[model samples]
Target: MELTNIGTVRDILGRHGFNFSKGLGQNFIINPDICPKIAENGNAKKGYGVLEIGTGIGVLTKELALRADRVAAVEIDTRLLPILDETLADFDNVKIYNEDVMKADLRGIIEKEFAGLRCAVCANLPYYITSPVIMLLLESRLPIDSITVMVQKEAAQRLCAAVGTRESGAITVGVNYYGTVKQLFGVSRGSFMPSPNVDSAVIRIDLNKKSELTEEQEKFFFRVVKAGFSQRRKTMANSIASLMGIGKSAVYSVLSELGLPEAARIEQLSMEQLMKFSVMLMEQTKE
Candidate 1:
């Protein structure tokens, strides 16, 4: 049975007396094609451990359990526990935890249960918590090899945005620092039950082994990036000045020394340039 087929999903939910909750972002994918595609993009193969968030009705969870060696799904809603049990009963390797993923100790879980394996994270992220969830996975020490997630289309654009684009923001730069993000495919709003107002896109993030800077340098770079976008309409120099509580003239001097345009907006600077500017700011602060 196709996972995305409304009839099948509805039947499963109805049988279990399940009611979709908007607070949980319970717009389940009704398309079978998207489920396996998400697994494929996540590189979920036999012998790989997969971490899935929000296993509502086990639509995507079923696919992950089928393709991956072991699947650990963290679901927030306790009501879905029995539903997941019914759907995933045949797979012994699959474990469903009733907890908020944001608060769950994923690293400890992975270390204890799935030690010494390359893990991949796959999810149809809740629209409300998409950014935080993705950031949480990326920053975890659990050794995630890659991530494939279905997110709101606009958020996907921002995640994959180029430096010069309007969609570029602090999150874009942050995402770039950890990995390369690419939009794989798009799904119509109608493809979901209790359809969302906007469409969604599948985004694949490939973690990079070589980081451009040391940990300290990256932290400082993010501080500057966040300051730059703190006031989107202001020039980078002005924004940085406001954020740092420094004079605009000093900020302009830093920009001039770095050869960046005085009129440049926060969205105009590349990641490398932002790092350079951040380093300059730190040096000046020390002086």
Candidate 2:
């Protein structure tokens, strides 16, 4: 059977009486070439373990299995299990895990399934659950080499947004603190079985091997980041002051000490500036 063919996918679903869940944000990629592109851009390697989330009909999973030493494809939809079992029958390296990624013990599973191999995350992530999934993977600190995901185009832009730009959000800042992010490619809405309203794009984030940040400093950094981004239109100092329980004058004083304008918006600061601000704030809190 042509797994990436829409007719074949429909036939498989028909045989099993499987229905697409709107709540699940289900969209299966039906383009054969697209899967290989995602797998290649994700850096799936001969000796690496590729973690695949949202394995719709096992198209991308099959592609990853061809490259990676092992592929742990996690699917939340129980109905697709039989279809996956059939389609992935030929692939010995692919293992399907029937579990919710949000609730799974990912670290434990990675340790047992991946073992000594380097690991990367590759997924056609659901739009509704994209942020938490990506954030969980990043914060898991699981010795991940890279995270390559296909998300909504707008989301991809916000996630891989350039520092010091309005496109950057708190999530973008948080993501950069862990890895270097870049846009891999754009996948159109037409590529999927059930076409979505907006287009999608792929992003690749290579995790930083080392950061010049202490654990205590990291805590303060994110705290400040959270506070600054609490309100998008507000000035950085004002927003941070409101959320951090500090006086606006004190916030402005620190900004002036760093040679920043009192009117600077939260999105205007780069990752470097945020880190520097975190250090100064840490000193002030200590005093």
How well is each residue in 62-120 modelled by candidate 1, as lDDT tens digits? 88888888888899999889877777878898888888999998987776657767788
281 Cα displacement, candidate 2 (Å): 1.0
lDDT of 2: 0.87
For 132-200, candidate 2 gives per-residue lDDT tens digits of: 998889877877899999999999999988877998988898788888899988888999989999999
TM-score of each: 0.94, 0.96
CA lDDT for candidate 1: 0.83
Task: List candidate 2 segments past 4 Å from native.
Answer: none
* Backbone N/Cα/C clashes per model: 2, 0
